[model samples]
Target: MNIKKTVEKIPGGMMLAPLFLGAVLHTFWPGTGKYFGSFTNGMITGVVPILAVWLFCMGASIKISATGTVLKKSGTLVATKIATAWVCAFVFAQLLPEGGMVKTGFFAGLSVLAIVAAMD
Candidate 1:
C-alpha cells in the first residue's frame, strides 16, 4: 500500500491524519507521549512544527500591500464570529446563578473552554 496515496485520500491528511492517529494512541494509552524523549514528546505535544510552518506560510504568502484587503475580507467573518460568541457567552452567563461562566451546565467547564477557544 502506498502511504502517500492513502493519506491523499483524506483532505488535509498530511497534517490531520497523523493528528488523528496520535489522538487515537493517546485515547488508548494516555500519557504515552510523555514517556518518550524530549524531541518525540515535543512533536507529539501539539504538532507544533506543523503549526509553525502553517502559520509561517500563511503570513509569508500574504503580500504586505494586500494586507488591508486581506483584513477587510476576513474582518466581516471575524467580527460576526466574535459577536455571536459574546452574545452566547452573555446569555450563558445570565443563565448561571454566579453571574459568570466558571463551572456549570451539563457541559461542566465547557463554557470556559468555549470562550477560551473561540477563534477569530
Candidate 2:
C-alpha cells in the first residue's frame, strides 16, 4: 500500500499511524521505551538544530502583505478551536477516570500553537 496516499485520503490516519505504530512497537519490544529514555540527552541535542532550521524556514515563509487581515481571521478561528478542544478535553478527562493524557496534551499543545500562530 502507498502509505502517503493512504494518509492523505484518510482524515486523521496520518496522525494515528505513528501513534498506533508506537503502541505496537512498545507492546512487542517492551524495553524500547527504556532504551529511548536512556538516549534522550543525545536526542535533545540533535533536535535543537532541526528545530532551529524549522523556525528559520517558518519565519521565511511569513508574508508581510496579508498580515493584518489574515491574522485577525486566523486568531478568531484559533481561539474558537482552542476553546472547543479545551471543553472536550475537560469532559473526557472527567469521564475517563484514567485521566486523558493524549487528549490533555493535544489540547494543551493546540492551545499553545494557536496562540503562537495567531501572534502578530
Candidate 3:
C-alpha cells in the first residue's frame, strides 16, 4: 500500500502518522518499545541520529544567503505555535483534575503528550 499517499490524503498526516503509531503500540503492546530498547533492536535509541542527519541535510540544502530569512520565518511560526499551545495547555491544566482520560467527554482525561503534541 502507498502509505505516504494515504497519509497525505489526511490533513497533517506528517505529524499524525507517528502519533497514531505510538497510540496503537501503547494500546496494544505497551512493553514493545522497552523490549526493543537494545543495541541490536531499538526503539528509544532515540531520535537524535535521525535529527542529526536531518539537520545536516537541511543545512546542506539551504543557501547560506537564505539562512537568515528561513530562520526568521520558521522562528516566527514556531513561536506562534508554542504560544498557542501554551494557552491551550494552561487552560486544560487548570480545568482537569489530573492527567487521566476523561470517560465522560473529549478532554475529561488528558496527558502532557496530548497537550504538547497539539502544539507540535
For candidate 2, write residues 1-120 as lDDT tens digits: 887797768677655664566567657876765676745433233446545655677667789987788789989998998777776655555654343333454444343334334542
How high is the CA lDDT of each candidate model?
0.73, 0.59, 0.69
* Candidate 1 local lDDT, residue 28: 90
Per residue, candidate 1 scores C-alpha lDDT tens digits across 45-105 of 7677657866787789899999999899889888898888777777766775563555655
Query: Between the candidate structures 1 and 3, which one is better when assessed by TM-score?
Result: 1
How does candidate 3 fare on TM-score?
0.46
Best by lDDT, which number?
A: 1
Off by over 4 Å in 3: 1-51, 98-109
- How well does candidate 3 score on lDDT at residue 89? 77
Give the TM-score of each candidate.
0.48, 0.33, 0.46
Please write out the lDDT profile of model 3 over residues 1-120, one tens digit for every residue: 988798888898755676577667677887776776663124323466545654787579899899899999999998999998888877776766654345466755466558778677
Q: Candidate 1's error at 103, in angstroms?
A: 7.7
Query: If ranked by lDDT, best first, what sequence of candidates would result?
Result: 1, 3, 2
User: Distance (Å) between predicted and true CA of 58, model 1?
Assistant: 2.7
Which is superior by lDDT, 1 or 3? 1
Q: List CA RMSD, all candidates.
A: 6.2, 12.8, 9.8
Name every residue pair that clashes in candidate 3: 100-109, 101-109, 102-108, 102-109
Model 3, poorest ten-residue lDDT window? Answer: 39-48
